[model samples]
Target chain A: MLILNVILVIFLIICAVAVERTKDLLGAVIIFAAYSLIMAVLWLMLQAPDIALTEAAIGAGVTTILFIGVISRTRRMEK
Target chain B: MDDIIVKTITRLIVPFIQVYGIFVILHGHISPGGGFSGGAVLGSSMILFTLSFGLPMASRKIPHKVTSILETSGILWYIIIGLAGIYLGGKFLVNKEAGFFMGQAGELISAGIIPLLTLGIGIKVASTMITLFHTIIEED
Candidate 1:
């Protein structure tokens, strides 16, 4: 359990940095979605199922769609 | 976007997502999930549909006007229910003192006004998500 938590946290840090470092807006959004998924799973492990559910639905689901829509309206590659 | 396989899979899966969302909303009082989470789940299903089919078809199914009405009515319903407590000579949003029926613990029909409030919140949140997504997507 501790090892799993450590691995998730490490992945989360990597995703956070990669989202910022990525030059492509769409790739950043996708990475952010991955970050959210990992955070949701961590929330579940922490016994806050409600937060986990919200994180998955809003973070992984709707936010990704919204971000993609914005990217379509503007540009996919960051300046 | 125009793939037959994507459309077929979306059609097959959306119903289950919606059912699970409703289940989460309805069982909120006795379970881990509540209005916001369930409503997000419900709204995401519609979003998935929009992604699979085009925006035109999705908008036809859940029009902007319908979502607007739903958003307004959800809050209106919540306010009406809350005011019922005052009408019954108690504090605003009071449950037991408001004469609401509280059933057994962990039952579906228990929790008095909480379930009703959750329903209102669920409706509001779901409509809000749909409206926001539609507006963002449709902007020129």
Candidate 2:
């Protein structure tokens, strides 16, 4: 389990880099949402349900909503 | 550097990452992972999405004020819970004496209001992360 966890962490780290490399801001947001979801799962596996739920709702849900709103405001500004 | 590898890698690893994040959050009471760690993961995930999809795409689904509210509300929830514990005739965050939980270390109800506190913390951290992501992604 420890080894698996390590591998997962490494994977997350790499994905994080992917988020930085992507040019499409929307794609980046999706990846970031994925990142938050994964983190929530990790938290659950680690035994923090409260945290996990918060991550899912606030991190993945509410925050995402906010990002989308901002995106709509500035869609024309993108290259 | 390439889209294919990055996309494939994201597709493969993202699930595991999210699962692990939940694991950590749940295991916080039993181990090192907790609300803070889980929240950080959420923030980073959104950040990644922003980087790959562009800030507009990510922001299109949500707005900055919502995140700000989440952050502040989470904090208020935490303080309210703690104060509730105090109002109930125990010290701030008083667990065993407060009668909010069973008082057993491993028991779900044992931590009294700690879990609630953690929930608030997780929200706060995650929302804050989103706020930061908005700032970075919006920048030209």
Candidate 3:
């Protein structure tokens, strides 16, 4: 279990890096979704079912939707 | 000296930031964190995503009306669950006297209404937070 947690943490760090490296805004959005998915898994391992489900549904599901929506309306016209 | 380095760093890590947000949220019950902490993290994740994706793509995924429903539903669910405790045996949100196994420590159903209450709160907090975040950045 300890080792698993360590691996998970390390992987999460890597994902963080991936999120930062992406240039295209749309690509970054997809990577962010991956991050939310991992976090939901971590929550389940931490004995937080309520949190896990919420994260999965809202964090991954609704949140991703919202981000995409906002981005479409007001793009980075400056660039 | 600092601005270039900061932007470079943020660019590299921004894509995966939402994962960290979930990490904070899922680990809420045991540690000093929970739904609120996690929810905020999730909100930030979405904000950052919007910052990158632009409003058109963002709006295509999450419209304002959906967020409104999510926010209100969460509030209503929390209220209804809390009221259940009042009608059961104790005051509003008094879980121990509500309904559950009410026997043996560490039993699956022992905590009575606590689990249900937590579930409601978790949903309320998570959806509401997401809704608020969406509202702020949503396409008009």
DockQ numbers for every candidate? 0.91, 0.06, 0.05
Model 3 misplaced regions, further than 4 Å: A1-79, B1-27, B101-140
**For candidate 3, lDDT tens digit of each residue in A10-42?**
888888898788776766777888888888889
Candidate 2 vs candidate 3, TM-score winner: 2
Best by lDDT: 1
lDDT of 1 by residue, B1-140 (tens): 79999999999999999999999999999999999999999999898898889889999999999999999999999999989988995778989877678999988998899999999999999999999998998846
Segments in model 1 whose C-alpha atoms lie over 4 Å from true places: none
Residue A68 lDDT in candidate 3 = 72
After superposing candidate 2, which stretches have Cα over 4 Å from the reference?
A: A1-79, B1-4, B107-109
Residue clash pairs of candidate 1: none
RMSD of each: 1.1, 10.2, 11.9
lDDT of 2 by residue, B38-118 (tens): 777766666666656566767785578888999999999988988887988568866666667556687654566777777
Residue lDDT tens for model 1, A1-79: 9999999999999999999999999999999999999999999999999999999999998999899988888878878
Reference interface contacts recovered per candidate: 0.92, 0.00, 0.00
For model 2, state the Cα shift of residue B45 in Å: 1.4
Model 3, B56-111: lDDT tens digits are 65557666567667667766877887887788867976676666456565544445
